[model samples]
Target: MKRSVVVRLLAAGATAATAAAIGLTLQVPQAAAAVGGVTGYATQNGGTTGGAGGQTVQASTGTAIHAALCNRASSSTPIIIQVSGTINHGNTAKVSGSSCNTADGVIELKEISNVTILGVGSGAIFDQVGIHIRDSSNIIIQNVTVRNVKKSGSPTSNGGDAIGMESTVRRVWVDHVTLEASGGESEGYDGLFDMKNDVEYVTLSYSILRNSGRGGLIGSSETDTGSGYITFHHNLYTNIDSRTPLLRGGIAHIYNNHYVSLNESGINSRAGARAKVENNYFKNSKDVLGTFYTDAAGYWQASGNILDNVTWSSPGSDTNPAGPSMPSNTTVSIPYSYSLDAASCVPNVVAATAGANKGLQVSNGSCTPVSPTAGPSASPTRTAGPSPSASPTRSPSTSPTASPNPPSGTNLSLASGAGADGSSKADGTSYGNVRDGSLSTYWSPSGATGDISVKWGSNVTVARAVIREPSGTSGSIGSWQLINYDTGAVLKSGSGAGTITFTATSLKKITFRITSSSGAPKVAEFETYAS
Candidate 1:
């Protein structure tokens, strides 16, 4: 296992859980009162005006509202505003309030904290970003719906991020915030939430981003200040198209997030940002990431992130490069070079509570280490004798041989196995199969029957034994398929119990699927055969 992976799993998971629990229990605390009678942030009060269906506030203009709200502080005094009717900028969702660009639209903040922004009435339609924070700390933005901020005409030259956060902002919490249609070239911007500058101890949870051109939310660091100690969990990144910007910036923790990118990378961390991309589901991404810079000063860390069943929108070939391409200057080997073992990921309470030091622990979970085992080896214990049944019977084995160069057919076989030491460690609840022996596991879904693991050795197609489930259990040993993990090709498939045998040059790992009828089913003692 790698140190980067272990540290990432702990820090990112804990921070996100803490923020969620805290945010739910203790609503965002109000900012402390302004000190020394300083100027506070302000928002434009567009006076009531008659419209076609209802009366609208003149200040309801995103620019006007932003001008009135930016940089204004509500210290010991909570400055609150109530508005009525729709605030329209453009029709597109990505347009920001800054696009209105009346000099008055820009609100500025300095030396102020303990601020609150709440929406009352139906809340005016937000043509621009509802609120923008800059050079401020101890800030809370909650219970606000920032919607319909498309540019009506053209966009402001530089435009604004729906929630543009810059400068050094610390201990800031944003919750129950809905940012809709806030990104794209039309708005001359990117991302529903863009936060740069020096930011730390910040948490964004329970937030929803929809109909955006780029990332549901985006984070980066100022040129000098490094962006670390940030948590983005429990947030839904949905319906992002080609317009979405990359989801990440500098070093941060991103997990437990359901990211769906119709067109673009699900989550990208560029500019040498170290991140832990874990437990996230991405749909239609060219690659999990474009690149992971592993240079001395820059690089993003990846681990435990499930790349399960992602369908690529466009497949690129060697000659034409229109779709996702393989990573450059990277090695593609049988065993993942820095892969983390399955058992090590879970928690270990004994080690966790005993030391009480800073480390990763899955509160009520424990990680039981499962060592890797190799195939059968040659030894002189048993002498080779023939003519028992006239023709020699195939031997049950694990070791496999490589195929000739440019071999055809799907690749298959076991990659690693239990450790040779055959030792077991039972410090907690979970158990690890430490013993080095012939044991097997199988998956059988309803309406499906058989599955097999095949390997080729010495030009012999060896079919391993079948360890079917106990009899009279209404279990079916058919309807299973063997799939090669790397090339996404089917080696051999069959229905009903029996044996499936195939010969291939080399083997790594194979998957047996039961078509997922109702739920996933498990069987004991799947056979492992070799020739």
Candidate 2:
């Protein structure tokens, strides 16, 4: 048999051939089993043809294998041919082969279903995509690594996603596959993952997202309700070097993950949407673990999460001196509400003393036993208890100027010599320090007996009385006791005034109206001192 005989049979559409040269016969199985219309073709063959010495003749080749698979008679079965080597598209027709070659493109699945493309590690590298699934279903792309997919559209507009899901793609499962570098536009904005508009009922779990610019993972919602039943868990966000998004969204369940060395935030819920942040560990949350927005209007419920290095305004500075101010980046409006949950629920106080937190227990429309959260280290700093028997000092400085001026632009006159009508004046001595129509009046020790009082007339009752001692004198004083000279009941007896060492109890209006006395006593200031 001549070598030309074998080549002639291959060109004549024979499956396989046999050549006998120098009495040596070689037989070849020309047809490889084709499952459907699909057939196999390779650019190079390793001399599978057989015969002896000058009897050596090239037998039937792969060219005959291509014609058999391309011209299938049955429509029910498509040929499945494996390409051991690449076949160029330009030379495909002249060589009797399928166009599963050349870098231009390979394996185009057009409007077909139930196709599986398996790769042997590095064999899936394509000049274009290794596999393009368009308008198809029941498609499985398993155990393949597609490196560097090319782009068809503009990166700024509709370039491409690592895996593009159009308007109506359902029940698609992309598992255990690596979509390496493979740059395109539209979504995937330099990330390992990206999805947009109507990506409903989708899940990405147990995956590693790293070294992408748009972040580890990114997604957005077209409608206010947001898109997808998104679940992000058990993934490590490492070196996520993007302007934002270590993982971002509102309708997402973010839990059990570690976020390390992020630039802007560990996780950001855009200033517009409400989100639930729970049970996640954050190590260095530089400025904040998370920031909720008020301008865009959303609620944030933070529960059971470990936040280290989160910063808020200081309690000692004026700008944010009393902690974070209400109504920040987001606006919240409520109708006179309160909370019962103790973990982070506390009432906002008003009309209390400057440095005190109004009490939480309110009874009979009054605030009682007001207490603030513990200072410095969750423990209240010790305050000296009140001494029941001592008269108290009103002036924090305890300075006694013969004429202490009231704060400017007010009528706190202290020059009249008679105590107001109901004051407790001395029996025989004319003290002459009482002022009938003044706001703040003080009396010094005119005699050693040391008895004095203020008389506020019947028309108006004395609202409060604050007494102070002369500076540098540590003497003790008797309390300011009220007396009704007509009935002599001594309505309220002296308990003793605050001494040089004690401060007094603050008082509201103390009324004194006697039937026996004709007119009301008039007093503007309180008077008391030691013997």
Candidate 3:
């Protein structure tokens, strides 16, 4: 379909990966190896051990991304592209029939293999544009946000899905992303993320789907059952109307996902689709898991799911309750060799690590123990073959630095020493972001009870300690403490992320210990001004 879109060439420089020091990402250690056989989004399709390789370059804008993909299409050399800046498509149209075609505005990874696309810097947002991946393998997309793409009001392809894949796709992993919309197709929005037509072995983890009527789906139609073997774990689905996802005739392992604020139905599995729904947290939703509106029907084996404050729909002829029990139908065994965090801890883990730019701090969070279980088939279902690609980069987290000079004679406390009692997500940037100075960055302790403390080189006069969330952040600090490490005294304590004013005193160190929080408290800056 030809349409009016800005499918242009790119500029010179993009951004770097979020790993240490930026511009480089290494393979995950054995101890840190994740579920889906690979680590980081880059290896989603396939990792360095698979196919993607070559120099890692940064790109910004849809044009730059397209240029990078186009440049690498010939050699088939593995590549990692770190994208920065906001790529605004602005009602652009699709220009090619191939799913991976570069139609200018929307970034398409068509006919590519072993590639990792990461967002860098403050963020990389694809505003009003969708990402299409087709005939590709071993692809990873992380720390990116795609929103506001309208299917009806403007020019788009495949219904303006925030991220869509189809045709001979395999081993694609998407993590720590944010996909949102203001309305459904009637309001010009489609699926947050969708897959179809022979897609398999895909995973979505530690990401978010919000403010849309549709979340995602696999196997576009009942006959398109070739798309299966999908995995979803540790994601947040909120403010969405339906499709907690619509699975059709595929085997999906869905676990540890948080569902909230749904007005319509959720998880409509039908057309012979089967899911093993485990350890999920749901609140204020209706029929969170059941058969689709169609009659073909679906089945699930649910275990360890918390449906707190959720309302169940009446059991109609084709409806089935998805919560609080496991299905009596065929039980799907977990093919992965992995561990699980406790159901109560799912919300905490997801809140701390899901979405872009908070440091991909994946917390173990008090999980129950389990043994390695094999798949139904004796042999391995999938092993990223054909030599692994280069390891993708993780975002480099910068710790807080002491202000060079405090305004009006105040000595900004340089954290000569810093430590956290415990943290949920710890990919470098942890308690130190409080001193990092940039409001765009902040420190979020896993769960709510831990303390992030900063120590000075020597004793200094201190009067006030100020703490606040990043700009446009609504995370609330219910109650917190300002402690003097020298004397082990609580100089001040208060609720909310506002400034904590206390009498100026001499102290060597101060700590910000949070007692309670509404959402994960994001401390952008924890400043202590000298007396």
Candidate 4:
């Protein structure tokens, strides 16, 4: 049978009884079956290939899912468990084996690796049964629906997360699943999808997270800064109160997602978290991006996003909204390659391709839904350059230079006659702070990019400059230019804050121009050297 025909039959709710009556037994897909390829950051760290050449088994109950894991030949053995029917607490029990660790009431994927749990044959639904993963790697969960798992209610599972991962988890790709809740913490529900405790290199793609108080979070606390390198794309977030994943001290790529009716703050980036948000559509949301409910600020680099009827609240000591006019405050460099559907088509594309029971369909990056067999092509319909409606461009320097160690010389920036100035400064920050020689005090641009210069009463021959960032906030400065302000000539240009050597230029003034950044660039010290 053609793959498209099978997909159509499955999408039309074909039943096993009907297939049996028609003298056709439903066969599980083989190891090479194309459910969809891994995208985003999950493609890093040796890549997330889950059970590609492993034995495929059928599972209807949660216990069977546990048994499938326990029955594996070894803890690292690859296996794909095809789940169907409704999985609930009554049918779930603790299963023991040398290879698996499981508990009652939840689908626990613990201390195991190279596993894939996929929905097949009339669909798989985990009703009030959450999926928990811990201390594992290279796992994939796809085409399943988990709803109403609570943290504080009766028969709670997985700490109220529809899916939760922790304790050094890595390389998990969750795709085409529905994770939802009926209400907020008052109703005993918690996050839909969450990760913490050194979790890294994960991706949540083409999924639905809706009708919940909290969508998800990267780190569990403000100080839990170890987890990072996540991607959320082509997902639908609707009727969520907050956290659309509160990020803390990690780098996240959020793109091509559809957000609607966010009751409160969304994408709460805090505790030094940095996000690259692009090509998404937001409608009827409030405070869609910012740091909220915490004094510790987060940062974002936004572009190619369409915000329709979004509202922003007044900035407070603890609330900082990025909307009203969302601008890119940073520039994040993504390692992997992926295509993007236009922001205008994100709503339509996400609605058609996201969520379970959609035949595992995916986009061809031009708003066209294609069969999973076609897979994701590399033909990018859109480039990473800013959109037409994007914020005004900040031109970077033309000449690129290599970063080197700080030159051994006198610090010219701290001279008695030296003075500092900038194009603009953020609140509570002064341009003079960059030469103050204290890492505790720093200077930030009014927005993402600006210039700060150190001027001398007399001309001085400078050979190098060292750009130092504040502690705990490294890697904020992106593209920058070292210019002789007296001559308007760029002496050196590069990305990142470090020492750069240049020909000795005798000038009265020199400027360090930040043209791009991953977050608010905090220049603790911009030291000029005369070697």
Report the number of the highest-TM-score candidate. Answer: 4
Worst 10 residues of 2 by lDDT: 39-48
Local distance difference test, each candidate: 0.36, 0.29, 0.65, 0.82
294-333 in candidate 1: lDDT tens per residue? 1222234344454444544342321111123222222111
lDDT of 3 by residue, 394-507 (tens): 223222222333345543744445333222322344666677777787777544444566666556777766675777886477766666643334566666665555667786
Tens-digit per-residue lDDT, 1-531, candidate 4: 234424533554754443333322223446823357898878765467787777776778887777667756566667787888899998888767767899999999887778888888889999999999998878999999999999996989999999999996878999999999999999999999999998888999999999999999999999998788899999999999999989999899999999999999899999999999989999999999999999999999998899999999999999999978888777776766677888999999899999989988888887888788766753455555335345222244443333444467678999999999765567799989989888899999755766788989889999888888886777888888777754345677778877777888899888887878887888888899886
Angstrom error at residue 240, model 1: 1.6
Off by over 4 Å in 1: 1-103, 106-111, 120-125, 148-158, 216-225, 242-249, 290-531
- Please estimate how well model 2 matches the true structure, expressed as its whole-model Cα lDDT: 0.29
Q: Write down the TM-score for model 4.
A: 0.68
User: What are the per-residue Cα lDDT tens digits for candidate 2 across 1-531?
Assistant: 334434544555543332121111222323321111110000001101111111111212122222322222211112322222222222122122232221123333333222233222233322223343333322333223333433443222112223443232222333223444432233244444454443323333223334333332323432333232334433344444432232234344443344444433344444244344344444443323333221233334445455544444332221111112222233222111111111111111111211101121111112111332321113223211223233222233332223343323322113232243221232332323333333343343221212343432222222223333334332334333333221122334333223122222222112222112112122233442211
